[model samples]
Target: MALLHRAELRPSKLELLVPWLPGRPWFAGEAGAEVTRVAAYRFDDPAGEVGVETLLVRAGDGPVLQVPLTYRGAPLAGADEHLVGVIEHSVLGRRWAYDACGDPVYPPLLAAAVLADAGQAEEYFEVDGKREMRPASMTLTGSRTGRPVPTGPVSAGPVDSGGTVVRVGEVELAVVRQPVPADVPPAGGLTGTWPGQDEPVLLAYAR
Candidate 1:
């Protein structure tokens, strides 16, 4: 896996995030807040150019949060089955694939993403617990066609305190952001509860 830490994410990653950050649920900017990278990193699929990135952003009043992102060269061909929506990259002038929140890659990458933000071995280890999290099994059929769910394609699943979503094929695995009670220890050892771990509700993927 191509794991890129904060320093490696610079220039290139920053350029990608400039326009992408504002659209996120965690984005505090009502008028598109200015984003500065506090820390960042990336991981690449061993087989292909599909890459995932973990970014820590200092947006505004919100806690410095880790935002995990994935980059693909092109959209998955048969993704209509799991279609969520599209995110337009201002710099690239192209649209990209988004996937289900339960894409299986999230918890591990989320742990790695936490390490990218904390910048310490012990702090990084704290996220190891998250690596063990898996998506809850569901019995629902595909909403669009009411067909049995099929296996999805290569996907990017990003999880943070605000929420977590995975976009693959045409399905978006959405885990709504929930408020973490004062009793629970925060994920990633950041200031507050991480986005995905709180109360999660799945939303059908859309643009």
Candidate 2:
């Protein structure tokens, strides 16, 4: 479960992403188009120190683009090259955002979602000393197509904004950056549903 706060974010996620999206080689969205959030989902950090989020956005009428991010109070050592940007959180103070594919916390969790059937974290709103379950902007479902359970440390290979493949002990999980209708979603991955979307779309797959 993840706790949420109704606080302001300076240079919001979209603000940060718009400037960075066009630089990515895999960015297929229209150039110079305005970006807007479509939906988002979170995965919890067992230690409760890092914030894990996978955001979906669209530029103009272009296809949805996926951006996985991790937030930390302090810079992650040895990950300076992967830094997304810095932002100020009303309650959390300064936050360092990084590309989730480079964050050490992401691969294992993603692998679990693909192999162990781990789903998105449950979120709660925290304000005025009261807690209430917050409705998800989107829902996530993990599926494993009869693959053997995962084992050992998880590590992600070269990441492609188009699709990322992370290697677990013996299984390889392919995370889809854009849910296209043409590509067939393979077994053993994750799917998601959000407002205005008629059907659950494949978010990742394992083979």
Candidate 3:
């Protein structure tokens, strides 16, 4: 139940992206841009020590993108290449960080969130194309361990805006009434080969 503020979650590492945003195939920012964190918040993880944090970033000429991440203890042994930029904590007095996208714990947590947030009670759960969806009531309590176990299935969808084209998975399966964002084109959804993967899937249009 402990919530953290953007400033409280200091960056263990901060690297400037002079041209990173524009070149990203999924990024919507204008070419040759400079973006920064506009907001951030942490979520609980019931079974692990490190928690999940979502950083709301604002790229030049783009809408905010929610980069879901986790701060880890040891640098992920093989994920050195995916590091976004480490942050040195002024309060904890130690450098603590890691990317959950590269970590193993994110998929299930995401699946559970989609079900709980959407209020579906009969869906299943699985990871890495394992065909593992089960019926339960789960909630993503935090990025750290100790979350409640009421699990459900996750739906994927595209989240294009500004100049970026990122996918969001584990959305509630319930039929949505909301209009899809105008910036996100219809053809831009999750596309992968794995069955259990939470890749983005496009839904209703806003014509």
Candidate 4:
């Protein structure tokens, strides 16, 4: 389970994202628009140090944007360009945030989820002196096609960070940057639905 602290973030996640969204290639929303969190889900890092989360947010009257981010205790080497920013966590001290795509630690986990029929990590919150289960902001599940899982580390291409298509080992996972079109092909990958969404859309899929 992932722990949730009641402590505050100096520059809130939204504060960091609002300005960064307008510059991303996959971002089509209006700049200077109010950014609101739609939903978020997380994956556990085997090392238990890095934090992996996929955030769904909307800017103005735009579509839900999917952003995968990783929070680290220190700077990620050779990932200067993908650095989102530095923020002070009231509980965890300073953190360096980066786009998960370039973090090296994210792809294999994503690949595992895509091929192993996995789900998001459970969340736990501590209050007073007690630990309690905290409901996820949204739900996510993974389904695998008939592909073999990788035994070792896997890599994704177009690693400049966000991409429309990411090649993960034998399966190429396509990112659904916006709402799914009516003609979207049925495929296996991580899928989720949020409030007001009529159908569950593929957030990422093996193509």
Q: Which predicted model would earn the best lDDT?
A: 2
| TM values, all candidates | 0.40, 0.90, 0.49, 0.88
* Predicted structure with the largest TM-score when compared to the true one: 2
Best-to-worst order by TM-score is 2, 4, 3, 1
Across residues 1-207, which tens digit of lDDT does each residue of candidate 4 receive? 788799899899888888888888778677978888888888888889999988888888888888888999999888898899898999999999987877777776776676676778888889998989987776666775666765454444552233455555566666666645233345667777667665776777667
Candidate 2, residues 85-181, lDDT tens digits: the string is 9999999999999988878888778877866678888899976788899889987777765666666666667666668776767777777778753
Model 3 misplaced stretches (Cα beyond 4 Å): 3-23, 36-41, 118-207
Encode model 3's per-residue lDDT on 28-125: one tens digit a residue.
55555566664444445756466575444556767544455667655666666445555555544444454444445544454444323321123323
Model 2 lDDT at residue 30: 77
Model 3 TM-score, 2 decimals: 0.49
Residues 1-207 of candidate 1 have per-residue lDDT tens digits of 343222232235445555655665655542345566554434444354555545556554544545555555566565553333354544443444333233344433333222223221111211434432222121111122232232356354565645665554454443333222322122212223234434321212222
Model 2 worst lDDT window (10 residues): 180-189
Candidate 2 C-alpha error for residue 58, in Å = 0.7
Off by more than 4 A, model 4: 151-156, 159-162, 179-187
Cα RMSD of predicted structure 4? 2.5
